[model samples]
Target: MSSTPGLSTTKQFRNLLLSDQLEFICEAHNGLSAKIVQEAGFKGIWASGLSISAQFGVRDNNEASWTQVLETLEFMSDATTIPILLDGDTGYGNFNNMQRLVRKLEQRKIAAVCIEDKLFPKTNSFIKGDAQPMADMHEFCGKIKAGKDAQSDPNFSIIARVESFICGWGLAEALRRAEAYRQAGADGILIHSALAVPDEILAFKQEWGNRCPVVIVPTKYYATPTDVFRQHNFSIVIWANHLLRSSVTAMQKTARTLKEQEHLLSIEDKVAPVSEIFRLQNAAELQEAEDRYLPRGAEDTCAIVLAASRGSELGELTEHQPKTMVKIQGTPILTHIADAYNAVGIKDIVVVRGYKKETVNLPNLTYVDNDEYAETGELASLLKALQSRKGRAQHTIVSYGDVLFNKYIPQSLCQESDDCVIFIDSNWREQSRYSRLGGFAECSIPNSRRAFNAKVYLKQLGNKIPESNTHGVWMGFLKVSPAAATLITTIITELLAQPGNRKATIPQLLQELLKRQQPIRVLYTVGHWLDINNLEDVVQAGEF
Candidate 1:
């Protein structure tokens, strides 16, 4: 458990759209902030070398005293329950320092950490006119391998952050470094970029989406929409320092008001009341504590799958029926989605009907009519179903209607203990052999705070669901809970506030999560998958 003040700080930032997963890793900021964030329900904590160096009003250098970093890690980890990941700038020294830093961070019980490929006193990459060459790929990989071997827990992730993109090393250098990092047993890679176009980001994801999960910060360049990244399969998009950004803006506003008005109460309208400040996070999630009806048992978990419309995207084959209905060896894709959950013994089916609802009906099924389905994505249909359920289940499963994958929904659903879990394909390896459509859908969860569409959700798995249960999105399958249903409903309704043109896609909805920092459970699916997106897909379906 976290301290009350720390939890409250977590809630406060989350209320302001700062994500708990974004893990505020500051180089110079107070380590106490770590305790604050952990209490706020953040999944992890971060220590940034850049910010830490700036704190002394001195530039960061490769020779940054390791004692300071060690002390920071110790204090932060000792104060929080969540994992603490530190930014070990250039590994504090060399291969030996890298080894020492690994031991030091673990001694503090830090969640995970990273060491960048940069030289001494590395000038800020984001600063114009500032440039530095990255370390040799072989050497960086060796350091990463050393760190990996030092890790005691297999799940304790070690990220290899490549600054080649930001350092103007170009894509070739970045990719080369990324490959080296992955080979070095780096569990993940964060492609540091102070400047990146949408296509470049997509290219990066296309190139290395499957090699290992890639992470990024949208605020790095302040360019590219959330949808573009979603299409590319860039797994982790940690929203960088919005709290500091907002704090700066708010402070300036207050200063201007007081200076101009000649009074501390210069402007009242500019000041947001507490009610308005924490509405999205504390106001809403806290409401769940009161209105949220605690379930009596595990029976509250429900499995849901929304079928995609039959479109010419599949060509003349789907001209009569929907794509989900298009037979796969005489069995519909919707059936596969159902069977995924059926394998787990959960037969309560909730289908969101849109373009040809009557064509996919089954016995004992609950149909959630999405009259706007043709105009919206699977997310809209999910919203309608959540409203229909009125937060009925303690947990729920959600999946796209057109997916063609093998899964064991019940077992998967029972594995996680979060409010939302996304069934990702562990084998969803991308290749140029495919078309230029959406690549593998990467799990770029904003954090465990931002509100997201019902296409993903959480459900407590503490209760027994049996060893035979399989949670998969094969062809189609997903699960969630009553608590998550309510949150998603709120997210959908909030999306309605956005401009009409942008509210139609789930990825667009995901952007909203970036601003909201809602929590989600992203579970990788260890099953086969095929998307029925276009005519070629129909050809691909036959092979499946």
Candidate 2:
């Protein structure tokens, strides 16, 4: 439903290098950290080998295998929208290893890799310092050539990372290695230095003659400004290890404070709110998957909305239209309701239609005609729609056509595992039409240990409505689990057979299910709902 253009992150990364502007990339160890880096406004990500190894509480001396690092990079690629440049430490092995690494990285949509010219199972440069062994010139160049040959995308970069300074080999060796790597078809050169300043890195960029793009990892020389890198014509700058390191410090401090105070309330205000965490974790997206793939009769994901009512009480609003067909802000009210469902990834929709059924057409929807709309209630229309899906769908959300609520309501409903779940508005008295409707039925659920995951049992169902002591009013959204489908169908049949309950309502049907001792629960979502009945209700809903 979105019209925004898609971006090839690989091409965009290559373009950033081709452009004159310097690219400042952030480092991440996992998917969530990568997303955090992106959210902080960085242009690209660096999948640091050290950070990934540290994540598993291991040293960064090839302790974590290449496959483990590759898996981490894959998660980063999927989580963040930007390109990732992986720290391919010593290419994991020989030229053969380098070739396989390139192939795997390209498959995961990684934009680039920076392979250091060090022996296999190399130690961390910053820790080992001055004692690390550099790989043979011919051998390292062969590895670079192999990686370049294995690259699947023309834009995929293979940057040769030179550790001459780290190995105590002079600037001359670093420059020589840079030239050899460039000749060996490496897309760029990353000159690494463990010094407290960028003097050696800046000198390398100057002497290298800009033959290829230059990269710098200023971990030790953190104070070097971006303008200095731009002055030396460095193409990319990686602030590697900051995110993982900062996270550790923050977590440690929080843990210590919690231990000292023996409670979390003191730190609650300082920590990230629960809502932000849910948004970052893509809770809504997860619920969409739950709604689509959970099996009911055949497939678990499906829903039905009863839109057959003519809403005769709305005066001219339904003179020749069904209640759902009436427009709110130039869009059909039913479309708005359907949009809420679609937003949460419920695409298999069934709309029960009667009055002006021809005008209720929408894409990707199945329609069931309720010719008895003038003679039946909403429950009858729902029963007609459920016939086609009797024992199949894993879960079904049945909602009234005359109301509107936030997408979160249905998203929460899909995430719940209850056999039968009902939605309620605890603050329904705020509605403008509350007084006019002469108050709805009260269904109170008490707060007791027995009430937790309680089996709701209705005492009776007829002209006398079931009363609940709970604070909320039913909002007409129900989630029916796969195991309850047959029970619901049988109950509908039995209720229809009884003369006194021949025209049973939705609440009445639910009450009958309760009497049968069904496992039922309630979800209370308060302010975000609209139940349009008359013109006054429409005006109030629009204002809301």
Candidate 3:
């Protein structure tokens, strides 16, 4: 549960109900949607029962159990500081159940609950409007009384949802029930109507005289202007279920379009970006907490960028600087790589520089000179970097400096719990920029039964792998766990000692590891990376 420093959530909700000006709340079905509602400036949340049940793919008729609703409430309460008024359908049962629910809701810091005057396993008010019978007024009043008695917090609210109008009961019965509920200790009365106008609600308000604060759900009559509710001095107006409705519309459209087109090119820009999701999930907070609380050894993840080559294929672009230093959209590819690493909390970045090594400069980086870079390959530069670090890194990310990738690639790779994991582009065959020269990987087929734990192993990794046997092209990025780092350091040291392997590349090193029966997992991605291998590649990378 979350709260403001000076005011409790219950008290805040009570204030909203009793305030002179009208207050509004939007409906949310889950934690993420609840937080979004709060972020949208709503002072409170209406945890709509219909929306919650729909989210579970169940009917609004209490097909989802009370415990399930409580669990969802827990998440909604924890995700936001705003008060939540849960639509507790018929209090889940009688007075005993209402009492227990009140206790549990108070424990979870939910501000209030609105239980409609209907039988247990209630149907939605808008559905079969005149057919659903309202619960006995005296019995529901007792339920409200029990809930008020059970609440330990003084300000916890119990709003009685009067469904008399929906049941075709006259305004007189609605007023009578409202007065009885007020006498029975309900904090507010939420008068519901299925009419296309606010006439019934206004008529009830005119006679009831706001004996207790009146709440309104004009969901059926949304065409009515807000000023009408304010004119009648309605305390709260609930825009219930719109968020879930809008989300359903969006998801359906996106799903249908993607299914028809069999691709995301048309729909990608219409939806939220992955980074937006990370932001809403507060992922940076967890990363900050990990940095502060995780063990020093566990946090000791570093990056080794094999950036020694001049990328002569890029023509005059590398005349004065290394290929990794070439500007892409006004930023160096190495800087972009470093930024990607930094985004995932890899601060200990080491760049292996050789050609124009003096020209490569970046803040907060530890440079390792690979003077033999002109004669050696990526494996030799990696060897030099590993030898300099002396295998202290708990996890190491080795990436080609000229490649630019989405931050999610490294973020996803770091989550793998394997000895060694390589990023592979499964859509490699469709890419015109890639050729036989790029490193290809052959991975064991993933188990179809265990979707969550379906691990794909690297059966072979090298440029020499036949295209027919290859699963994907390696993206020149890989992560090594502590044991894998030690094993790699040892293997590279021994291989370099036998000078014949001096110019071995990263794929060659991976192939050697595979030959020794080392288990290397594969993290498959489609294509969110750019490999700047030539002048055309450089132009494409500029747009990346």
2 against 3, candidate with superior lDDT:
3
Predictions ranked by TM-score, top down? 3, 2, 1
Which candidate would rank higher by lDDT, 1 or 2? 2
Q: What is the per-residue lDDT of model 3 for residues 268-299, given as tens digits with 9 covering 90 to 100?
A: 99999999999888999999887777543324
Candidate closer to the true structure by lDDT (higher is better), 1 or 3: 3
- What are the root-mean-square deviations of the candidates from the true structure over C-alphas? 29.1, 18.7, 15.1
Model 3 clash pairs are: none
Question: Which portions of model 3 show Cα errors greater than 4 Å?
Answer: 1-5, 297-300, 303-544
For residues 231-312, write the lDDT of model 1, one tens digit per residue: 6666556645554445568878898878888985556766867665465234676557644654222344566667645566
Candidate 2 structure quality by residue, lDDT tens digits, 64-174: 989988888888888878888899999999999889988998899899888998888989999877887889999999998898888878889888999999999989999
Off by over 4 Å in 1: 1-28, 39-41, 62-64, 128-130, 251-544
Instruction: Assess each prediction's global lDDT (C-alpha) against the native.
Output: 0.60, 0.80, 0.88
